[model samples]
Target: MTDMVEAPSGSGWKLLAPVRRAEGWLASVPAALPLLALRLALAVPFYKSGLTKWDGFLQLSGGAQFLFGQEFKLHVFGAQYPYPFPTAAAYGAGTAEIVLPVLLVLGLGTRFAALALLIMTAVIQITVPEGWANFHLPWAAMALTLAVYGGGALSLDRLIGLGREKM
Candidate 1:
């Protein structure tokens, strides 16, 4: 008589096959959730800073010039406006930050909002050479991530079926 070997069925390892499959399905959550959380968390600081600047636009202009004018002199590649460019830049940045952060939080026009925020961040990065070392790279990274990923699953963009529409 030939000896026969039987394969294990419903063994502990076999039982874990379904669990392993479930884990594989859930792995994407780790990557996506953190990006979504970071975007949401950043919205608060951006919105608050924008509001503060809007509340004191004049002061912000003066502050912007005082803080950024010298740096602007180095990297700015355009004809200097007669009045201070830093002030104008500051106001433009403030307005974009205010409006875009709200849109970003709502996930409406997410790509557009991310682009606006990216512009504002680029302006700040260029205008404040000293601060650039600290925040410029990180801000650029975050803005680019948002621009690419776009508000993720929890955003109104997804809820409203905007994600289904072609950009």
Candidate 2:
């Protein structure tokens, strides 16, 4: 026997029939595409940003250093605080922006990568509070979704039997 449940007959049900059909169609769509898309979407921005942070292999760019050491500040309760150990912060951020996004795109250690990016997104929000509506919110949402959902069947996580849950 099929597990599908039929909606009761009524005007409201008639109105919702198309929606139900659409829902069914959506259900038929494979989870892999969306999961892969999510991974790529989240990876692109961070990967691009990471590219700008380095001038040479393992070398932090002057612009990145200047921004972290002098320009970027943590906003808290109407107060702005400079980042402590700014050089270390810059290096750490630069490295993570590269490494984590690569892991996310490859779906290797996907949950951990997503969680790291989510944390980075949170820190970015604190640093650039005004970007919440435009950039930070979307990044956080994507990261959170990936973190919770895990990489799907298309992922290394699944191939390696890491995140056994389907996206």
Clashes of each: 0, 0
lDDT per residue as tens, model 1, 1-167 = 11175436767767867776777777646444655665666577678777666446445644445544444543466433232675776677677767788887777777677777777777665555566666767766777777777776667877887654322
Summing lDDT over every window of 10 consecutive residues in candidate 1, give the lowest-scoring window.
Answer: 74-83
TM-score of each: 0.62, 0.89
List CA RMSD, all candidates: 8.0, 2.3
Q: Would you give me the overall lDDT of model 1?
A: 0.65
Q: What overall lDDT goes with each candidate model?
A: 0.65, 0.90
Residue-level lDDT tens digits of model 2 in 1-167: 12368768889878976786888889888887788899999999999999999999989999999999999999998999999999999999999999998898889999899999999999999999999999999998899888888888888888888977644
Minimal lDDT window, size 10, model 2: 1-10
